[model samples]
Target: MAWYMNSVEDLAELYNRVKEKNIPIERVSDHGHAIGIYIHDPDGNGIELSYEMPASEWGHDPSGYMIGGTAKGRLSGPWDEALARQAQVTA
Candidate 1:
């Protein structure tokens, strides 16, 4: 199950909350057009809490799907850093 977060700030705050609660994080994945904080539900279903890139930054595939390839060599931009860049992004 994937839940979309409204902004990087919301995602970053949740990241901090998840850490404080000591919940095991599955992974933080950067999917080019989105960033997700993944974890499992109590019933063991995989859950992705994500923030998508602005419409301007999204890419479309020739096949009609949104581009979602992960970045090569180290996933970039954990929640907090991404949140910090929101200022630049909005500017």
Candidate 2:
């Protein structure tokens, strides 16, 4: 999915709420400190909600791509800046 969370605990709670409401989740995974959760919306598009830190040693990045973090060896893209910021603000 294009957007997601960065905290497993929060994602877990959300997942439970949706599931309790009769929503079905496609799958879930634990990528170290990150938890990847997926669900298919009514239109059949797979949406993913996850909790993973940015791929950077420092806390913030202006260029949107800072290296050196736990996700190093994992094949993944840089954290979406807008998505990350939204998560932070909402949290």
Candidate 3:
């Protein structure tokens, strides 16, 4: 149902482009381990584009499997910076 993206840069780029084109973005979210950008299709189905924290940054179990809970929070990062830059550009 969600989590599809490679990097924050890619997410920011897509988001900015969408906004520039006046397309509606459903929402954005910062889940401790990842950043998610949500959008809706013409059909009204929701899609999530996200950038996940690298494995090296994640907590690992004794056997080396990554384990942890994602903290739900506000949207942030390169995405926020992107919005700011757009504001400056349009102003």
**Steric clashes per prediction:** 0, 1, 0
Mark the 10 consecutive residues where model 2 has the least summed lDDT. 72-81
**Residue 64 shift from truth in candidate 2, angstroms:** 19
Q: In model 3, state the lDDT of residue 15.
A: 72
Regions more than 4 Å wrong, model 2: 54-91
lDDT score for residue 71 of model 3: 48
Task: Answer with 2 or 3, whichever has the higher TM-score.
Answer: 3
lDDT of each: 0.68, 0.56, 0.68
RMSD of each: 8.7, 12.0, 6.9
For candidate 1, which ten residues in a row score worst on lDDT? 68-77
* Regions of model 1 farther than 4 Å from truth: 59-91
Per TM-score, the best of the predicted structures is 1
- Across 1-91, the per-residue lDDT of candidate 3 in tens digits comes to 6756677677778777777887777665666677877788788888887888776766677897656636443336656654455457769
Using all chains and alpha carbons, the TM-scores for the candidates as numbered come to 0.62, 0.52, 0.61
TM-score of 1: 0.62
Evaluate residue 84 in candidate 3 and report its C-alpha lDDT on the 0 to 100 scale. 57
